[model samples]
Target: MSYFLSKLVRFNRSSVVGAVGIVSVGSTLLFSDDDTRFRTFVTARLPLPSQDASLLTLAVPNDLFPPHLPSFGQHGILSLSSYRVGPGSSSDISKEASGAVHDGSKPCGCFGRDTIANAAAKVGPAVVNISIPQDFYGVTTGRSIGSGTIIDKDGTILTCAHVVVDFHGSRSSSKGKIEVTLQDGRTFEGKVVNADMHSDIAVVKINSETPLPDAKLGNSSRLRPGDWVIAMGCPLSLQNTVTAGIVSCVDRKSSDLGFSGLPREYLQTDCAINVGNSGGPLVNMDGEIVGVNIMKVLSADGLGFSVPINSVCKIIEHFKKSGRVIRPWLGLRMLDLNEMIIAQLKKKDASFPNVSKGILVPMVTPGSPGDRAGFCPGDVVIQFDGKPVESMKEI
Candidate 1:
């Protein structure tokens, strides 16, 4: 029972389930997001009677595996092999979210119905699967698949920094190779041009024989909650797979997600993003790319996050001219002051700052730039560069 439960599916609360079943250990489990199921090929290293089975291959109902693993997870699966468990399989969200099919992407009509096929028609070809080096008992291989978006005629692809650089926190650059496969079934050698750890965005180049199709960049600044969007990626090694969702929050703060950096804007969506969907494009109704699918919340349903394409635009533009991103850094741990935080701080110390609007500097690095400038811990920064500041972006 334990062995069979190891293949358990991590289901999202929001995803709809059409059927449920169990597969024994050494047997097979089927998966699908629609009625028309495709043959899925799953390869795993299992300890079965055949002790020499380095990789166990299986044929399932749908040609996709649910990322039910611990990594790259939340309510949705990571789309990798036991890596980031993909969310549990369920029926289409569009049909459920919207009561009717969309004649066009009108806000009052249908929310997510027919727009998926339309966005897929425009941006699907640009979605590519990224295969990076993986180590199985010191034997290097390229089996871990992540997704990417082709954005330039010169074959420039946009992906997450975690996908191509220092993967899985290994921090090793001497990996075997990077392979990019498009929806057309054409594969090419890919090279990492630049990667920014701060933004978790990376750029890659593919030597294509001809000008390739690319996704159109859209204005992410206009994104609002409840706006329909489509997430396109190769989750579970399923190439060109698409998921439908709506924007849950336009400006999800980085700190709220337990990230240890200055706050940044992220688009929260209910898209069924899986492990292989990392670095794919989140497209709007007009078939314009709005964001890049980055990650999902763990142990929660309908909580996926994406880096706004507007940020990607800036990072890519910087990469073009300087071959890297230039970021202004301050060595201080700070938080945006709010009414609740201020009230809590005062409870700890009656002498806490009475002011409500500003950034609370809790800790400052010993010898960093901020220290050299006479900054100290427990200080409230009300201004930066002659402007009153409340958030890190102001500084």
Candidate 2:
């Protein structure tokens, strides 16, 4: 008979139901005679709750082995014991709070319901509902609803560029009018000071008779995955809706997600962001804005994405100086090549090189710099100015 120890114990007990019994010396224990194995797994190591900790023992029948493991007719019991060390310092607590030890459950204390409620109460007043009226041939057609965050006491709002721009990707002038509704039920006309399509950010200003509540901006560079966060927005035309979630990832570049034109990193979250949530503020646990909710994957759940607040700040500063964003123009249409693209190209043309990555030029303007430099369709750009171009955004 052979004994096998596993930290994650899973088994198919269809052959033996009444022959097995699981006993726990301490901690919560659950038993089942069904064919399905336990859904949750126990970790090998657990931290000490205090200076003095006791031992915990768990026993399981040897017959409850998974199908992949070797089947041995063992009559002995499998005992698992866990011992806790001394008390951890404050730094260890901080690490745990930052989700260093993710146990698929929310940590206690700092992430309690009261903490989230307080954060929402503190930042709720600064969130505003934005409505843009769409018109065609001097007649009102429809309205676009979104959310915004007040960034200044004088009612300067920050939101997504698409909220203020029309369907044609241009700033809506005669066809639309910007309106901002505050949390206190006050509505005011807002004017688009500037909008940048590259970053999908826009700045709108409302000349309010009284000072408005401005939300505090936090440093997004300090954000980490699993950090507690709240998303405040008007989703599905609901006003002042707040949803809670954790930071799923940081430093996600646009090129990594098949969006090369953005040319910047994004903050990925699992917050319940839906339609009309765009341009809303993604606040941290401290009630400070860390990101702006942009869009989410339509086909997947819990795959929401946000624009980093730091990048939005830079664009806001640039808009303040110049009326519009100034981007270096290289008149060329290109596509970044990946493994799948290279495989498809090789199938069509056998002479195509088995390259790993490159930027494939699809078109070049007639009188553009690319045309002047003798660039043409089907040209693969592998390098630019002595540097390797792995993606179109890099070029």
Candidate 3:
């Protein structure tokens, strides 16, 4: 290959190119910038006897190192623009001589090709495709597609709660039922066995066909950015699809889509997750499931979110017993102390009214917690259980 062509190939180490070079009766040789195995090619037009069988060696420093191992059993040279070669004409040729394979350096897993394939094969089966019937108006018009991970041999599927939430026109019918589709294309009826809207996690139950393929859940608590990860899901309902990328970010609160009232924490990733990719499993290079894929802003591409698998497990266990996620509540709706409200308070006596700080106790329930806690009109509550107070929105 020409020096210019080889230089272009240097920038793209993963591509293989084909070209021609010339062999001369007088030794004709070439050398790479740093003794790297630039690439292999094929060509004709030898300067020497066509059947000479002489090896044309490229010069390299004995102490220099190459970027990666050259392709084995596939290395060949080609003849380029030379006096003996007809212009714009070339022939196919093969070399019996082998090119040296470069083992670039450690931490470069170029040598771990088989290891990565085997790991993916082992974990791919555990990532499942999920389908839920979405009820719009009074009819079930379509289905919501997402992904899930089988967490038990008896068939307990764990997925994002938002993937299965019923959007009934009225609160009375929000209790509509949900169904789940497995990776094998078998669809089964499932109920919202458990749902934590705050954490956006849900668990579904399907009858065991045999032993279920339970995923090897890993600890997301140990995750960090730039760690290699594989997101396995049915994005757009494509079952067992795998995309590889580095962990873009961890413990991100910015992209959270759960209830605005909750302390939402999430794992942010740049993996290509699209519609129907939600509720999948994000696994580390070790083939361990780390996070539960959850949400993505529609306007943003390449932005995906997942709830830490550790948090999902805890919420699932909590829902298993409590029937609902338990969250602390002060049960008051307060108005903010804006400039106008502050000016009014300043005009009042030294001890401003309850509306100055606490939830403007609009109308308390007759015998509820607010009434029993001495939370009545004209009383400003500056704290809740020793915690500094904010608007009831903080409750």
Report the number of the highest-lDDT candidate.
Answer: 1
Across 138-173, the per-residue lDDT of candidate 1 in tens digits comes to: 776336678899999899999876677552222232
Q: Which stretches of candidate 3 lie over 4 Å from their true place?
A: 1-111, 114-119, 134-140, 169-179, 254-259, 340-370, 377-395
- TM-scores vs. true structure, each candidate: 0.62, 0.63, 0.60
Clashing pairs in 2: none
Candidate 3 lDDT trough over 10 residues, lowest sum? 1-10
| Residue 177 error, candidate 1, Å | 0.5
Per-residue error for 264 in candidate 1, Å, reads 0.6
Better of 1 and 3 by lDDT: 1
Candidate 2's displacement at residue 190, Å, is 0.7
RMSD of each: 18.1, 23.3, 28.6
Task: Encode model 2's per-residue lDDT on 1-395: one tens digit a residue.
Answer: 00111111112222112222222111111111121132122222222221111111111232112111112244233221211122123232332233222334555454543555556666678888888776677677567778899989998999886677543444454445678898778899987776665566778889988889888898888787888888887765566678888899988775455432325688989887765778889988766899998766543457677889998888777666655555555566666677887676666565555578876665556887667766655566777666677765565
Q: Positional deviation of 355 in candidate 3, in angstroms? A: 10
lDDT of 2: 0.62
